[model samples]
Target: MIRKIRQYIEAQNLCLPETKIIVGLSGGADSVVLLYALQRLGYSCVAAHCDFHLRGEESFRDEQSACTFAASLQIPFLKTDFDTLGAAHQRAISIEMAARDLRYEWFEHIRQEQQADVIAVAHHRDDSIETMLLNLIRGTGIKGLGGIKPKNGRIIRPLLGVSKQEIMHFAQENALPFVTDSSNLQEDFTRNKIRLSLIPLLQSINPSIEESLVQTMAYLNEAGKIYDRHIQEAIPAVFDEESGRIHIPLLKTFPSPESILFELLKNYGFESERIGDIAHAIDSQSGKEFYSEHYRLVKDRDAFLLSVRTINHEPTTYLLSPTTREIQQPLKLRMRLEEITSDFQIKKENAVAYLDADILQFPFIVRKWKQGDKFVPFGMTHFKKLSDYFNDHKFSKPEKEDAWLLCSGNGDILWVIGHRTDNRYRITERTRRVCCLMMECG
Candidate 1:
């Protein structure tokens, strides 16, 4: 078993020579075996446990046992306790899901603080099979059948290629310490029901059920990559973003509006059923909009415009110079000038503004607008709400989020830049000289 595990790690190129690893120990048999096997295979490991205090004293025992096991190997140990039941009540989810979310959040926090290069989880072959079945039984797409990845971002599951039976025997053979969670043997949770009742029934037909499902998942994951590539290449052209709106043209253009809408709505985190609703909303006239936390898809002309809506940014400042760094996307900025030019101009197809450089300061900052950021609209006499100005201009949700302003360090508004230029800095005939400013995008 040890040799087979080593072979799997080598085949996958699992880890670097001395990479720091944090093991998520749930005091279960699978995690226990995974922790010991990683150490046995010559890797640096630390143990971290999440105590959700749902099972009263039993939760404390799991943390104690997890700590002792880490101490046994002289590995660093970390633990956090949470009001798991309270969170479940607040979120209206089961204790299990709340605990799951809490655990992963803490693991990420610890992973960052320890500067651990990789987080090793104990998700064996059988668990992947169970996940596949669970996703299929509920509503799922091709990506759902893909199961869990061996490495996602900073996470690594070294035991993915290992089976639960193999992990159990290895733990027994090494006299490893582990805890038995009674919930695993129950039929209450959906996963437990599938693991306890469904998988065994399927296994009766094929004893190698785990291997078959694992292989199927590998194939499905590969196919999902191809499908995603097609989605990425065509989605932008089919769905347009203009003036902070999201719209889909593929409804009339493509034969399958359902497939196109799914991919389009996905950009805004909308699921398949929601996509069906969003597609249905197209019958309404323009100005029809659907909103999410970060984005909104509105019906506009012939296309469905997807716009981002949520913003919570503390304004920031940046310096700009001709010889300095290249100005990039989604920025409103100002450039420095020693003196006013005879023809001061800022020219873009949509953005064109001129200023008198004599009164303008050298150092300026670019950041998001504040609550009461009133600016003269170049030819206007009064100030308008920066937010209201954006809404009145029909700036799409994303445009508002990406909107920025160049300001003097002394709190004077130079120009709103792309959306609108400020009148205070607008060049006039009375001005002695003009400073030209322009914006170019690749």
Candidate 2:
């Protein structure tokens, strides 16, 4: 089993000779075997354990066993305790998800601090097969079907070629002592239910179910590689990093736009279920928008704009006093109070707004656009609803959400700030004091 693991590591190019590795030691049979194997293979190894505090005393026992095992081998042991339930509540996520996030984040930190070449986890063929099954049950694309990878970035899974039976046999042969989590016997979690009930039923149907699933995942991984190649080639034509947008024309050049879009956006927190809706909107309308946890996608005319959602805990409305020269919150703007002269010229740019200071009130309000908001657009005689103005300008939902309005003290719109200005406050030849507002985005 050790020879097979060594050959697999060499073939996959997972780790270089004499590389420093950090092993995720959970005190389980698989992880204990992994730590022992890496040490025997002549690599500088450290055992890192995470006690999620989910199983009460069992969790602490696991940590203790892991530390003892590392000490027996004279390897450094790193451990951390987490308030798993508290983290789940704070993140508004499931306990399993919170634990997984905490585990990986801490592992990465340990790897960096120790200057380890790669962080190795004890995930075998059974775990990969289970992952593929879970993704399939949830309705996944090619990427999800590809299952677990042997090496992903700085994380390497050297035990992927071995089965659970092989790992158990090797552990017993080597007289490796390990602790088992009591939670594994419980059927509360989805993974536990699948492992305890679903996998046994499947094995009853076909004795070689795990092997078959592994083979299928191998084929799917190859197909995913091809899919990734096409996406990389298509990205140059479709995505523009300078403008931070995706061109719709180039996206249509692909035969499977829906699949291509799923592959492109899956990493950006977009779920597989939302990709079809996004693909449909790509051809249906130009103002449709979709949102994920960290990013937003807007379908603009002939393009899709991607932007990070800003979280502002500060007050949304900012005040500009009569003597104020600039305001920076929400957006950057330079305010200049000057007397309009015969040589004074109105700037043609929309970002620069010149208003009549005498007609406006003090403490100008800078806030986001609201529903039913209306303003007399510059050069227009009648009032226009801000919604209608947004529609006329073909603003997407995300654009409308991001739009800020500069208004007078009496709640009258003065400028749309980077788009249009109100006619009520526009500078005229009869005006004496001019309030020049210039927006600086770059």
Candidate 3:
């Protein structure tokens, strides 16, 4: 088993000979065997254990066994306790999921603190088979059917090529100290039910079901690589990263457009069903919008705009004095007082504003545009409603909401920052000094 583990590690290029590893030692049969095998294979190892405190004394017993085993091997040990049930309740997740999340999260923390090359967990062939079945039952995609990977970022599974039966046999042969969590016998959790009931039922029909599933997962893993490569090549054709827009027409040109969109939008929090719905309605759902937890997707006439959901907090008014050279809260702007010269040329860019300094009052007010707001646009004689200006310029809802205004102390609109400047404050021949404000784009 140790030789198999060494072969798997080398084949996967998991780590170097001198690579320091943080082993997730639960003192279970699988993890105990993993720690012993990795040590025997000549890798530097440190044992880290988590006491989730869900199984009461069983949790403490596991921790004690882990600490004792690490000590017997003269390996450094680290342990932490968690309120697993409380965490599950707080997160609104199952206890099994909460425990897994907390365990891996703490394992990464230990790895970073110890400066370990990788964090090793004892996920053997049986565990991968179980994971594949679980994901299939939960409606997973192609990636889920591939089962657990040998390496995931800094986390490595050295026992992925080893079987549970092999691990037990090796532990018994080596006289290893390990503890069994009695909870495994309970059919309470979904994973426990799968292991205890579903797998056994399958094995009863086909004696080599595990081997067949493992082989199927191996084939799926290779196929997933090809699928991912096609996805990588197709992404740039449909999605524009700069504008965060997925062009509907371009997306429709691809085969299996819904599946393509699913892969594209999944990272942005869009679910498979929602992505499929969007894809089906892409042509007819103009002006419709969909929202995920942290992102918003708007279907325009030609494309889908993906943007982060921002909080609609009350607009803050920042007062800028003459001495205030710059203000960064609402947006970044560099302010400078410049004297008009004979050869001075005004920049025609919309991002810059050249205001008559003497006409403007001190302590300028910077605030977002509000209802009934009007401004005399540059070179215009009459005041125009901000709404009319926005309509004429074809501003989107987000653009209008994000618009900022620069007002004089007496509340006279001077400039619509980054859009237009009031004609009343425009630089002219009579203007001796000018207030130059330039919006800095990130």
Top TM-score model: 2
RMSD for each model, in Å, please? 9.4, 3.8, 4.0
Candidate 1, residue 433: how far the Cα is off, in Å: 27
Ranking, TM-score, top scorer first? 2, 3, 1
Better of 2 and 3 by TM-score: 2
lDDT of 2 by residue, 1-442 (tens): 8899999999999998789999999999999999999998999999999999888888888988999999999999999999999999999999999999999999999999999989999999888888888888988988788778999899999999999899999999999999877778999877788899999999999988888888899898888888889888887778876665888888998988887778778878898888889888877767677889998888888888888877989898998876776887878988889987778888799789989999988788999988999999989999999999999998866678889998899999999999999998877768999998999987
**What clash count does candidate 3 reach?**
0
State the lDDT of candidate 3 residue by residue for 1-442, as single tens digits.
7788888999998999999999999999999998988888888999999999888888889999999999999999999989999999999998888999999999988888998989999999999999999999987779999999999999999999988888889899989999998988889878889999999999999999999999999899999998888888788898998878888888878776777788888899988778877887787845678888898888776788888898867558987777887888778877788889989889899789999999889888899889999989998999999999998897766577779999998899988999899998888879999999888988
lDDT of 1: 0.75
Q: What is the clash count for each candidate, in the order shown?
A: 18, 0, 0
Q: Which tens-of-lDDT digit does each residue in 188-293 have in candidate 1? A: 7899999988888988999887778888999999899987787776666565555433345555565556666776666668766677777787676766677666
lDDT of each: 0.75, 0.89, 0.89
The list of candidate 3 runs beyond 4 A from truth reads: 16-20, 42-44, 67-78, 83-98, 105-116, 169-177, 204-207, 236-243, 314-328, 332-344, 354-367, 370-394, 406-414, 422-437
In candidate 1, which residue ranges exceed 4 Å CA deviation? 89-94, 205-207, 241-257, 277-296, 307-442
